[model samples]
Target: MQLERGVRTVKLKDLPEPKPRPSTEGMTRITGRGTSMLQSKPLINIVNVVASATIDQRLDLKDVQKKFPELEWNPDLFPGAVFRLKSPKTATLLFSTGKMVCTGAKSEKMARNAVKTVVQKLRKGK
Candidate 1:
């Protein structure tokens, strides 16, 4: 049906009102687990590890920086030393207290490798 512009064919009150929600008293919860077609492991992304060690004495960041080419340290800005490694790829932070924080490792194996690499390098540096 064609109507003239700016005209109401039906009254606003004539429109049907929304029905109220049904009561939940008659409902029953499903007790059994549902079957699944997909059998894939859950995605576990972004794993990080923070570790510490107690050295015999306070570690010198400058010395670590000088020894490891991959290490970056600026005593004027921060007291921590950073060693970044590729291959299972992670960045480890070394502090004067012999504390270390390893981040960016995808899995526990990668984190262990990163920590082991750092410890091995530090041991060799001594």
Candidate 2:
């Protein structure tokens, strides 16, 4: 069938070089090769995670301010309302556009829990 779809050419380079093994025992073995080994887990602490959410309804900052007087809202400085939680220890930003930004959580799990707490509070009102 058409000469089995034509023929192809191949080339092989000549082996012309030789290298010596490392003199150290660590390098010769499979493990403990300098500081290049990969660890099973990372070695740092989780401190902060920023998360966002968009609500379907719009918000009124003036009404929200009256409802939650503890929340800090300075229209001259910033547009969003700043709410700080003591439980998970996170600072959340609530916008009138029904958007939220949460930060300063110790871990991913904590960050998610903090966001849930904020939403629950918003739904339940002050």
Candidate 3:
């Protein structure tokens, strides 16, 4: 027996209409244990680290890799990007996720200040 090898045909009229999605205004109830409480206010958390300098221009994958040899700087995997700067006493790691962890910083204030500066710069750029 010989099998046919050709393009198949279908009529558009035979197709069914696509289902409509729920409206945005509708209330979405949560049933999970962790999120039992209703979130009346906005949930605020850090998610981006703003650098003082223009990050896209000043920082790159190679720069981060060179400064922090410990971290594997894969731009593709970490799409947000990372910035590393080092002084005589301190080394700072700023992630796209609004969190900066500093090592060898002179003081806690210095580390906090650095993160604040970066956050300001990022916001200004945006």
TM-score of each: 0.56, 0.63, 0.30
lDDT of 1 by residue, 39-110 (tens): 334456565655444454678777787788768887788878888888658888889888788888877777
Comparing 1 and 2 by TM-score, which wins? 2
Deviation of model 3 at 4, angstroms: 81
Q: Rate the local accuracy (lDDT) of all candidates.
A: 0.72, 0.78, 0.48
- The candidate with the higher lDDT, 1 or 2, is 2
lDDT of 2 at 85: 94
**All candidates in order of TM-score, best leading:** 2, 1, 3
Best-fitting candidate, scored by lDDT: 2
Give model 3's clash tally: 3
Better of 1 and 3 by lDDT: 1
Clashes found in each candidate (C-alpha, N, C closer than 3 A): 0, 0, 3
Clashes of 2: 0
Which has the greatest TM-score? Answer: 2
lDDT of 2 at 73: 96
